[model samples]
Target: MDRMMMSDLLKTIFSVLLVLVVIIVSRNFIKILKMAVDGLISTEAILSILGLKIVLASAAFIVPAVFVSVLMVLGRMYRDQEMSALSSAGAGVGRLYIAVFKTIIPVVFAAAWMALYVSPWAASKVERIIFEEKQNIGVRAIAEGKFSEYNKGNLIFYVEKITTDNVMHDVFVQDKRENKVGIVTAEKAEVRTINNDLYIVFINGERVQGNAGEVDFVLETFAEYAMRLDSSTEIQENPITGIDTTKLLQTQDLKELSELHHRLSVPFSIIVLAIMAVPLAQVSPRSGVYGNLAAAFLIYFSFANFEKVSGSWMVNGEIPVWLGFWGVYFLAVLFIVILLVRLYGLAWVILQLKGKLV
Candidate 1:
């Protein structure tokens, strides 16, 4: 009988999680698609990339939601007197706890995989794809007859004609440096790459470089002049996703410590949350099955926020890293124990006020 109940509860939780994941993923994907369109990303490319991101994000978001939903479902069942019927037939609260424990072990293992392995791998791959696309696509976007500004007005380039080979005819280049304004005109120019640097090779051109309140200089260029184009700087700093869990464990850096704390906490949180949920799901005869859902949501969200706040404080050095990281979990565990004692009618004795107070 206990095994059957546990199976039913697991099925309910799985169904709820699936529905929630679909909803969240679809909503976020739509938002990302809009942003990609606004940024002029190709539709097919954006969809492909956004799909992967949505799956990763959905996995992270759904874990806690699954726990909450399961609690709500069980709470509703109790409120509707199904649990009461089982209790009358000799099923005890112990059975519920056992069921929850069975479910949580696998859930926590999956959560550990997501936080430690899957999420970072997905994030790193997505970041690399985005970087490559920006570099390659941006270079191809320079069109002829359009006044193109490169590097935030440091240089303005215009061409009257562009060919299939990216050669430009009647090219004009304007360089703005300090109070000086320099302009160069070339009869023909070609985009060239040398030593990983992008340059515009000009043929038959005259150069003028000067500024107001300064002596002006003018020179005629002969066969060729190479003007260097500034390219986007590739990021070299190690992103958080690039750091593995094992590597993080060996470091004492506050930021890395905080991230490691979060990774470890995610799985532990699943267990804590499961323990808290069982007692919270208890319902009186008069109340409906869904009566405690709002409260459960409130509690879950508060716990999540507390963890976030503690992690942030740890990273910022506003609190001792070890204390801030573990302190929140300890507090949560204490709260759960108190709630469980209350549910078991042992709170009065535990408070040591049974004889002293009414």
Candidate 2:
């Protein structure tokens, strides 16, 4: 009977965690879809990124949300006197932790897998997808009135306004494609596709062309100007966020070290948070289960946010790599100690403290 009851409890907690993950993933999907609709991203890119986004986002929240699920389940049980009944029936509150940790171990490993491997892989895919789209689709990938790099800094474009009919006004473009640089300023422009190719058509523009190394330079006024969108433009650097764990481990650069530690911290944190939640999840019989939910979220978010801050500090060389993640772990351990003391008794805690001191 105890085994069955504990099984059901674990199942309920997992079910709740699943729902929360789905809700989080769905909200992110809607946000990304809106970007697609607004032409900020291509339809093909959106479709390709959707699954990866869900996986990455879901992995991010799964471990943290586990605490909320456990809290709700345990809080409900305690609130309804189910825990009290089990206590009377020869089960200590400590017994509940046995079932809890059993359910969490597998989840902790899974979260670790995602944090260290799957999420980064997905991020790399998103970066690759966006890069490919920009290469194939050209300036159409950029919204009007924004500064955008054309071919990885070989060119840059800015527009003051874009009309409903897809016409642009007050255009500024820099051409660094060849040894001779050109700067073009136009009153109006149109991005057009001709013969299965993309071109920017500038009207009433002044073109300034020169090589600084030579004395020869030319400035010309044009009724119309056009430049082809080239595909050879490469992005400058791939970010540490998308790099593989093995590669990150091999590198000792500040940013990569920070990223590697951040990834490692995610899985380790599941154990920390799960421990904190076990005792904190206890609720009074007459009090609502959700009474502790807000506080739990607050604590969890504070911890998670601080992790990002520490990582930033690590990247900036404000702190050592060991300090970056270990400080957060210390805080978690401190929190768990406090929670355990509260769950047991102040008297027992003081006695234990004195014993340690002695």
Candidate 3:
């Protein structure tokens, strides 16, 4: 019976994980494609970045998939009266838990590795690839007869034509800096690197600078002028997701601590949710295998959202970092106990425990 249960659980977990991965990957693919279209990322880097994104997405969904899979497999057994047969053959709830946990143990270990190491590695790779692509974007990404935006839309460049040698003609540049707007028009322009700094060298250009709608505008015409576009010294700070697990252990920053705790919570949640699923999966034979899924989903989403809100609270200093992440798991354990008692009755549960003790 345990072997059969383990087999069903494994199959269900893989099926659910695959379906979830496909759904998430499709949505993220659209966003990645848009990033390529907007020139935020290179077309050549799309597939590489997308593959890393899949790793991250799969890691994020694995715990939830396992939880849901547990519910479905156990619920099906109950609906099919297999659970009744087991109970008749001296298989108690404790026996069922042993079988469920035998499957969960390996999953928890695999999930721990993914959440701690693999996902962070993939996130860092994606960030590094994007930063490297953006460094050369000013020169390589520009196209004739199209407006391109850079520096997060603060700078716009438009060129009427481009020669085979990569010189631009009839170039228009608009830079919005705080309250001031600067406009430059050039007869011809070409990219030049001076001292490792990227600059657009414009010849026979006119410049106008002033606050918008203000009359005190400065206007000048130049024989040659250069505008800095990017510099080799520019550095992109690593986001929380990209930080290595070992490095996160050395930090005392609330945001970093929150992130660290979140990674740790992934594996912890797999265990807790699996335990909760044992009781939560209980349903009447007539209700069908999926009958309790609505309630299970509600609990699952609430559990996930609670973790998110707690992490935010920790990051914002609203809650102590030590308590914010693990408190929800404690509440989940309490909920599981309450659920077990509700299903089996307090006296029966106590009697079962006492019997085991004796």
Candidate 4:
């Protein structure tokens, strides 16, 4: 009975996990593609980012997927009267838990590894890839006969024609700075990297700098001039998700604390939710196969929202940092006790507890 039950649960978990991942990745794919088209990220990096995204998405949704899978698998058993058959054969709720946990124990460890380690690594890689791509914006943004804007619209670059050897003819650049604007036109130009900084090197160009329509405008002509585009010294502020778990452990930042708590919650949630699913999956055999799914979904979403709200509460100091999301987990466990009591009766629960204690 244990082997058979575990086999069904594993199959359901895989199917549910696959569906969740596809739905999530499809939604994110559009956003990633838009970033690539806007030149915020390079086209070549898209596939790499997408692969990493799948990993991140999988790790995240595995929690919900496992919960839903357990509910579905056991709910079906109830609906088909298999649970009744087992009960009549001297099996009980404790036996069911044993079978279910045979599958869940391994899953909890895997989810812990992914949440604590792999997810952060993937996030860091994605952030670094995007950062590196942005540094090459000077070369990536070039297109003949089109105007491109960069640096939050502080600079505009136009190339009338581009050649095979990466030379531009009739290039124009408009740079906007505080209280002044500079316009430059060149006969020939090319993007070049020097000293780890990107520059637009122009040959035989003239630059005009001053306020608009001002008589004090300054004009300078040069045989060759260079304008710095991007500096390597600019630091990229990585989000908390990208930080290594080991580094997160060394800090007491509320935001970072909340992130650490969030990562830990995944494995903890799997165990708690799996425990809840056993009793929650109980339904009248006549109630239909999907009867409990609606309620289970509502409970899952409520738990998810509570996680977010509690994380915010911790960050805002409304909740003790020590409590963190564990308070929410505690409430979930309490709800599970309530469910088990309702299903098996309070007297039976107490009797079982007493027996276990003995």
Judged by TM-score, which candidate is best?
A: 4
Model-by-model lDDT, in order? 0.74, 0.80, 0.89, 0.90
Q: Report the C-alpha lDDT of model 4 over 1-358, residue by residue, as the tens digit.
A: 9999899999999999999999999998999999998978877898999999999999999999999999999998998899999999999999999999999899999999999999999998998888878788657777899998877788898999999888999999899987789999999998787887778899999999999667999899989999887544558878789889999899989999899999999999999999999999998888975868899999999999999998999999998986766788889988998998999999998999899999
Error of 4 at 307 (Å): 2.0
TM-score of 3: 0.75
Extract clashing residue pairs from model 2.
Answer: none
Q: Report how far residue 48 has shifted in candidate 4, in Å.
A: 1.2
* TM-score of each predicted structure versus truth: 0.70, 0.69, 0.75, 0.79
Residue 150 CA error for candidate 3 (Å)?
12
* Per-residue lDDT over 1-358 for candidate 2, one digit per residue giving the tens place of the 0 to 100 score: 3465457656765677678767877887898788777666777677778888778877777766777777877888788888888889988755777777877787788888999899999988888876656555546655676888767788888889888877889999889955879999999999777785678899998998898787788899999998888764466355677899999889978888888888898778877887788788888988864859999989988998999999999888898888997998898898888887878987876876798799
* Model 1 Cα lDDT, one tens digit per residue, 111-162: 7898887776777666666665554444455568987777777878888999
Measure candidate 4: CA RMSD.
5.4
Whole-model lDDT, candidate 2?
A: 0.80
**In model 1, which regions exceed 4 Å deviation?**
140-231, 236-238, 347-358
What's the lDDT for candidate 1?
Answer: 0.74
As for TM-score, the candidate ahead, 1 or 4, is: 4
All predictions: root-mean-square deviation over Cα?
7.4, 9.6, 7.7, 5.4
Cα lDDT for residue 272, candidate 3:
95
Candidate 1 residue 59 Cα shift, in angstroms, is: 3.4
Model 3, position 197: C-alpha lDDT score: 72
Instruction: Provide the global lDDT of candidate 4 against the true structure.
Output: 0.90
